[model samples]
Target: MAPPAQSPESDLTLPIRPGDKPPVPLPTRPTMIRGFTLACPVCGTRGLFRRWVNMVERCPTCHLRFERIEGHWLGSLSINTVVSAVTLLALVTVAMVVTHADPPIPLLLGVCSAVAVVLPVLLFPFTRTIWSAVDLLSRPLAPGEVDPRYDPQELAALAAERAERDRAGDGSGSGLSDPGPRTRRSDEPRPPRSSRPHDR
Candidate 1:
C-alpha cells in the first residue's frame, strides 16, 4: 500500500548520516538540567515514560531507548541509597534543631533507624527515575555510541550510511526543516509544554 501523505508538522524521523558525529554533549549546568528534563541527551521534547513508572520503549522525540539495558536500573538503586541517606541526615538535623529537647538515647536511635528504613522504600522509585534522567543527561555522545536499548552497531552503520549519502550529495534533505510553531488540533486541548530540565 502507498504511504499516507505527511503533514508539514508531522514528526520527522531524520536518518543519522555517516561522518556526522553524534550530538555534542551539553557542558553547562543549565544544559545538563535541560537534558534531564527533556529525557533526551540531544533535544528535550520527548516524553520518557509511557505511563507512571513505566518507561517508554524509546524516546518519542529522539528515539533513544528509555531503559538502556536489562538490570541497568541497578545503578538507580545506588542513587536511591545516596538520596535517601542525604534526606535522612537533613531530616534528622532539622528534627534535632526544632525539638531542642534531648530525647532519650534509645528514642533517638529508634527514630534514626525508622527514618533510614522507611525513607529508602518511600524514595526508591523517585531516585531511580532521577538517576535515569541523570544518566541520559551526562553520558558522552560519541559517533558510535548506541542507545543502549538498540543495537549500537546497527545505529552506527545507519549513521555511516547517511553520512555517505550526504557527502555524495544525494538530495534527501537535511535535518527537520522548521515546520513553524505547532498549532493545536481541533479535537484536543494542547498539552502544556513541560518545564522539566530534559524538556528544554
Candidate 2:
C-alpha cells in the first residue's frame, strides 16, 4: 500500500513528480543549501539543537524526527572524513608545488594539524544536516517513519496500519506466504525418507 501523505509543514524543497504537489509551498532554497543552516530539513527550524553537536529528538515546529534510526549519522562521519582528507591532500599539494617540492615541513604540519582539529568541529553541523538532505533525496520520507521513542502516539497508529495491511487480501501482502491447501497426487503415501532425496 502507498504510504500516507507528508505533513503540510514540511519545508524542504524537493523535486515534484508529475501529478504530485506538496500541501505546503517548497522552501525558497534547495534542501541541501538550507541544510547548511543547520535547520530541520523538513521544517527549516533553526533551533534544532540545545547546543553545539547536541541535536534535539525532533523538530520543535514540525515534529519531524531527526535521528530517524539508530546510527543514521554514520554517513556524516564518512562525509567529514572524505572532505577532510581531500582538503588535507589539496593543502599538501599546493604547499609542495608552490615551495618547489620542499615546503616548510613545520608550517605544513602545523596548518594541517589545526585543520584536522578544526574542520570536523566546524563542519559537524553541515555534515550531519547535509547527510540528512542526501538521504532524503535518495529515499523520500514515508508516512509513519518517525522514531518510536520520540512519538509514542504513533505506536498505536503504526500497529493499526500493519494489522490492516496484514488483513488485506492474501495477494496484497507477503509474510508467511502460506499456501492454504495442498493436494496429494493420487492420494498416495510419500516415499520413505531414505528414497526421498528431493524431500528435504
Candidate 3:
C-alpha cells in the first residue's frame, strides 16, 4: 500500500529532489575557515559556544551538529599544532631579523617551548568548531534526520484516533464505525430517546 499522507506541516520524509540545490555553493577551504570564525557552517554568527570551551549542541541557525562525530576534533588539534609551530617559527625569524643575530640558543628554545605549549590551548576550541562546520558542509545528510518536537495539533489528532480505536471492539481499520457497547449496532437499540434526554 502507498504510504499514508503526511500532515501538511510535518517534515518531508523523502530525499530532496535531484535538481534542487542549496542556496549557497558547497564550502571550500576559505569558506570553511570563515565558518569556523563565525562559529556556524552556513552563516557566520556569534555565540557558537553555550559555555566557555564547550560547543553548543547545534548551530543556532543551521542546526548542524557542532561536534559532528566523537574524536572529530582531533583533526583540529593537528591543525592547531601546525599553526602554533609555524607562528613560533615566524616570530623567532622576525626576532632574528630585527636584531641581525639569533637570540641565545637557550632563550630561543625557552620562548618556542612556551608558545608551543600555550598556543594550542588558546586556539583549540576555535579550531574544533571550525573543523566541525567544514565537515558538516562537506557531508550529505544522514538517514532519518528529524526535529525533536511535533506539532501539538498533529499529536492531539493521533491521540484521539488511538483512543477511538481502543474504544471500538476491533481496531483493525480506521475506527470510524462506532461499535456499540456489547458489539451491538446503534440502529438495533430499543431504549427510547427520552431515557437519554441528558445527552442532548
Scored by lDDT, the top model is 2
lDDT of 3 by residue, 88-190 (tens): 9898998798778856778788988899888887887778766765565566334222122222233445788898878774646666776766755778867
Error of 1 at 76 (Å): 2.3
Candidate 1 regions with alpha-carbon error over 4 angstroms: 1-31, 35-38, 104-138, 142-200
Cα lDDT over the full model 2:
0.74
Name model 3 segments beyond 4 Å from true. Answer: 1-34, 99-101, 143-200
Better of 1 and 2 by TM-score: 2
Candidate with more favorable, higher lDDT: 1 or 3:
3
> What tens-digit string does per-residue lDDT give for candidate 2 at 30-67?
76776878876765678776777787887777667667
TM-score of each candidate structure, all chains considered together: 0.44, 0.57, 0.49
Error of 2 at 1 (Å): 34
Clashing pairs in 3: none
Global lDDT scores for all candidate models: 0.62, 0.74, 0.65
Q: Which stretches of candidate 2 lie over 4 Å from their true place?
A: 1-29, 145-200
Better of 2 and 3 by lDDT: 2
